[model samples]
Target chain A: MSTKDMSERPTTVLQSLNAAMHRLMAGDSRVVVLGEDILDPYGGAFKVTRGLSTQFPDRVLTTPISEGAIVGLANGLALRGMRPIAEIMFGDFVTLAADQLINHAAKFRWMYNEQVRVPLVVRTPMGGRRGYGPTHSQSLEKHILGVPGLWVAAPHALGDPGSLLEQSVALEDPVVFVESKVCYGRFLTRPAELRAEEIRTARSPFPTLHLTHRGGSPDGVIFCYGGMAPVALEAVERLRDVDGIRVDLVVVAQLSPTPTDHLEALLQRGISEVIAYAEEASSSAGWGAELVATIEEIRASIAPRRSIRHLRIGGAHTPIASSKEMELHDLPSAELVAERLLECF
Target chain B: MKTGERIPLCNRDSSPNELYGLMFGIRTFEQSLLDLFQRGVLAGTTHTCLGQEATAVGVFSALNLELDCAFSNHRGHGHFLAYCGEAELLYLEVMGKPGGVCGGRGGSQHLQHRNLYSNGIQGGIVPVATGIALAEKLKGSGAVSVVFLGDGTLGEGAVYESFNIAALWQLPTLFVIENNGFAQSTPCALEVAGSIRARPEAFGIPTTEIRTTNVETIRNETSRCVDAMRDGAGPRALVLHNYRLGPHSKGDDNRDPAEIRAAWDQEPLKVLRERLDTTEVQLMEAAQTERIGRARERALAAPRYEY
Candidate 1:
């Protein structure tokens, strides 16, 4: 019984989130939805929460335009034996709730010596595409990576966001669920003519879809997630078609408490060079930097015999400008990934 | 008390004697901490609710202990002790012992026990209390949530946001602003604009002002407001106009000595003592002092929490 023959249809990222909320609330009465403008008729800013408040009138709460209060409110609800899904509207606004999210929610369990479990999911759209300027258009999940005791889940383009979101809600710890703004309307992709088993395996929870070219060991491996997955795939195709560089791809679904073991296993599969890319604003402590550190640690400890070279592709350190040119300059494109892949090889 | 009737200054269920006991316990505990800090026994300094005992004690007296939750600010020792009545845990937590409520991870400013929570940040718990009330409302538990904030917290934007949402949703929440006349060194008059009630009242929430340190009056007003909330009357604000007789924190007494001394006359202990017989006052004071002394010894002797 090959998994490829399962006949599962593709779904948009928005549909995945909506379906996840419906299923979560339907199955568990404890799950609640709260955010600004999330009530029916208004939905949310990106309409990800459309029809949710209407379906679950009493459970879904429409909060005021207060990110700090909204997050703190969710923390309170979670502490009081309720599973709360709080939406921050935009990822950039998470800065406003940093104190509650980082100091209170993240440390509550540890500080309280496990007297409480903060089972809350904060869903917000991250990454740039709508020219939302510096504040609105940001992959702010990078800032949340270093926070202790907080889990971060970012569903990739090929992965099932609904399944991941459900997992996040059921988790016993606080989670920051990041949905890519650009990926919301895009359809999940599968290589044409692939077996149903291959597609099913690729969509499995935390599965690393390694797409190799030339039917053998790839020249390099690229790691990415969310909106960057599609761009990375396009880069893979271009590298193989034009530059004759056969590269492999390892798209991650969970970023924080990163799937380091899976990444180490992928690296151990004999690709001598790897490239870690992120759409977040570049810094010394960016996600790409963490990935590089993990790669180096894994290489040093586990696979020292076959030392691999690593290159990181992250956003520009400067704030994203509203203009198209500067926006383009700020974020990494598939062409840039392709060029970087070729140069690294 | 009838549905629309106001709670009298002293009622059968108000338990003025027990409330007085709790107030005395809070004061004794705080005074012991001050002594401990001076002797270098307690590591970090604490913000004592010296002059604000009646505000916390009165409000806590009105709460349904089985259902209600409270969120307190930096001056939370009084609230935590008044609500939970666990003087030993508070002392142990301050001493960073394993037997403490939070296992010594959360010191004075971050004490949490059962339904009571407190943090050092101003206005941070306002929304958290609203959320707890919202949860209770959804669960059909008829429970009310209370938050104790200072006049200093009025400057935070989250406080107003919490009021707006709590009022809009009709959450069973009560916001008690301990207008201690000063936000640290800055006087409330200089920091706050207009009135403390104006902000919550703007959101259509009912407001009550209690200008005295009379625990009986505070208990009556809070009981009325809490009852209204239990009857689905949304959020209410109580401005307990009191003064901070002590400095904000240890060794930070920036307030005028004359003003501090003047505010001492309004101490709740003094007010309660005046109403009681001389023998009754002496008995209550002696009992509370012995209770705190024993709690301090136990807390000090408690084994340290190994991290």
Candidate 2:
């Protein structure tokens, strides 16, 4: 491995998203942005859309507090040959626009027999760490995970947000591009081999990254993305240093259309146990449940008859509390992740 | 379907026979669906536009079919037929045949044929239509987008939000409110508070109200309004005051039968039939029934979806 460039740090997720929007708007005249409180100065609640209105005043629209209308408007724009990226201020507010997204935007292409292409991108921030309470701090992407024809792309801590978003904007299908609230300011670091060149050139519907522990054969693997990406890495390092156990980390950039190829390939590496971590609540049927089912189905066809143990670590199944302690208790911390891995082993 | 200039109903190529033929097609098709439901042929219930044919035919007749688009509400059979005019396709869709518009996935409420889209959700299509208009304005296509909204949809906040944006952006959108007396089982008087036209008017959109069920007059006004929109007049609204001649759904008839009978007198078909020859109308009705019978046969013969 090459020496780390400590002086040179990677761009943050928010910066990457901002840069991606700017690039997309600059490249295509049909690219338009709409969101509540997305005007200049305020930019947005999270400021991911900062400087966009200033650069593209005619294209950037400041919408009212109508999530349903905002998404539907984007769909109309897409149908009219314009690519629109709608920003739902918070992930939880996506429930208001569920009717449009689930029914109209997702089903427009197939429902119309592929005569129309709805290239609408719905960008929203998910996950909570700053004690934003129950409404604001939720990983609600799982609720929409199973929606057919909808692509959900979540950026890891070190994932290329600009490239993922650029690909999302160019997609013919509707995409639910999720940005982690906690990971917006977090710096992205990757192995020396996984450079920016390869990240920008990724064209798959689902892009995955594999980081091994010091080039050693992995004892296990942890599958995660977005806010949990950093936590999984931390857990990996703790296991290697404290317990002398080496594990691999897999970051899945795409959450929907289920990334079956990349996942099956990972399982084909013949790992004995796989651990999945998510920021979503521990619902009965979530991304983890789907992932486990897919892994089990693929595992049945393996020649060696490998008995791969699948474990999951997710957020507590309760409303996020306001207090710092309760907030920490609600989210799956790195300590808890490492402890869970150790217990499973 | 021709663009550029507005065409008046008198100068248009459509004769009364064709117009009545279209109306008769929708009425008979919906009647057949009701009969099918009663005879245990159909599985689910459907909302029918039995009495609101003129509103769909009139407004749709004014649109440039090749350029302008439309979004309809639950009672959208008339709207879909008015735009596409394919009775066989509508039958296949309603009968869950693979030859349906949405390949049998979407039934009566969820109809999509070319530029036409309809869903069962109230007020959901408003924002989508506004966006379509926004796209039209941005492309400088001079094409307008029309949303067929029910009085019940007015209760939804998203509808007003779409109105505000459509007016604010000067989008060429037309909000056609089919203000049939009752929203499902609830009466408009009990559900809606103020005047229907006043709602869009507050958003600075030009509002038009048609009290009579005259198809020619409705088409004339719609053409004039559509021409104004094409001339960059921004968003406008029209409230077609009408009544439901049948129950809300197959097994939900909370409305008084006497009120329905009274409404049947003012129904668009009856109102428009008064202007046409009685003998010709009877022959047109017979032809419409035969056409619907052929369509039903084709739909039934078409491959049904297994899943």
Candidate 3:
């Protein structure tokens, strides 16, 4: 009933995701799996899609290296009353399919006056660790935020993933569901239900949407999302131990639609200037641009006196370095966050 | 009559003439669009489906109202109207006004409206439509996706990529190349190196080549493709030999209109009209014309698509 009890049993993030996919496959015939190296033998590059091919060999489709084809195929399938889940081997590899996403699926609904329902999910492994540098380490959230027809998802917890994943499939729109390579091992947390209900509702979280721990304090707030959320949380620990200044954490599991309501409230509660944005993407786009733009808009609308500051530490220009230590230097890590926090202090 | 055992595209008895009437409807639909273009109401350039109307109207006829999906190119109003009931929004789209399907942002090239979607980029909609076909196949709903591309699109690597997947998986898709003889003034002869059928057949798909001018031929061949896909036959390719009445767009008129003019001399539309009994075919065709005439009057009467 309680999250404490749930984590007592050991399980990998892949197991939880596999269970969700299994349950989803049972729930609807429209559900299909697609990706490279996803078959009876290898499962997938990281074993995430392992065993899927065996159970639902018919539904699990193995595709070629063409990113455009994979993405376009998913879009077409979704339009034909089927729920398709497409996987790009690497998050960086999806750039090759930009034509289908940025052009077709994303704009279809708006351009066509809601005549087409792009009910498909694109799931990929993103973020850096183990030296996957520039190309591999990129967080493409900003690039997609501007697209009108898509629903963006970045599930940071195991239990929450169930509801999020279910909702993503049911949504009558295209979705980009991302999983961080680094945060996968951590135990997932969800709410406790009573002795009766199956907890059938997929929209709301267990009880409250917020989770409180030593991870909560409000000297300042760090609003980060995707792979960078955990880093921001760790940066809080670094700030308190080193600078003796406490900070609060607000991680956005969803990037698009920008969570305007939650963000507006956090800033209103007497937090200092906001941090512009982070992660390994270009400066002109992504959270950095919208993060600061939101701050500026709220400042003008709510408080004229307050001003938010920015310190950006993102992916380097070169290809994602394969060497582990060099990879650490390539992405903005805890140290970079500590530096930014101290400068603010 | 024989292009070597392969059925000649101009086989009159092989196609469905009634379907030609519908393509005629789609043809005038394109003409209406062109008229709007000439009036400066519709913005951007378009690839009109004038001579290729049979392909759109005929193939679209094979679909179950909401079951089948279509992907179109820059030249796309005919395909857009093939699915009934949203013709007004299309008018709004080309007009580039607020009421447009994409709220005017997509304009002509990015035309879409739910299940019926299309893009202007060459070979852009091909792979995407093939994906839709794959989804239909996976869902087991017997749904199919049809992509209408120009012969010019053969140059894109993405099209070839989708072609491989569709044929390999036997996804329920049909790729219709409106071989309008020219890809923007460059004849297909100048652009393509080999025959169209051999290209797709090399990928393990069954290919059908038809002369779209003969509506009956278009209807029969495409109907077989759709039925075969729905029955789990995988994918099929349709290569249409059609010609444009004018230049690629409104500006270029370089063609020696002689062949087209001679073809028009046969008066296909007039002949179809004659074949119809005075009551059934004549009434329907005339009524169709009358309805469109009134539509034109109403369209011009309405507040123009202009700001």
Question: How high is each candidate's TM-score?
Answer: 0.93, 0.92, 0.84
**Model 2, span A58-172: residue lDDT tens:** 9999988889999999999998899999999999899999988998899878766666899999999988888899899888888898798898998765567778899899999
Q: Give the candidate order by descending TM-score.
A: 1, 2, 3
True contacts kept of 2: 0.71
lDDT of 2 at B263: 86
Best by lDDT: 2
Report the candidate with higher TM-score, 1 versus 2. 1
* DockQ for the candidates, in order: 0.62, 0.64, 0.55
Clashing pairs in 1: A3-A197, A4-A196, A4-A197
**What is the per-residue lDDT of model 3 for residues A1-345, given as tens digits with 9 covering 90 to 100?**
254435577665666776788788888888988888899788888666778889888989899888888888887777667888888878888788778787777877666655567888888878777566567776666667757666677776523555567777888778888877776666664333211111222332211133223443445656566567657656766776677777655556666656666556555655465463556554555566776787779877888876667655566756567788887777778778777777776
Instruction: Say which prediction, candidate 1 or candidate 2, comes out ahead on lDDT.
Output: 2
- Candidate 3: tens digits of C-alpha lDDT, residues B94-132: 666566667666766677665677787687688888887
- DockQ-wise, the better of 2 and 3 is 2
Stretches of candidate 1 off by over 4 Å are: A1-7, A192-216, A267-271, A304-306, B1-15
lDDT of 2 by residue, B31-123 (tens): 888998998877777888888888877887778887889998888988888887777887887887777777767888888777888877788
lDDT, candidate 2, equals 0.82
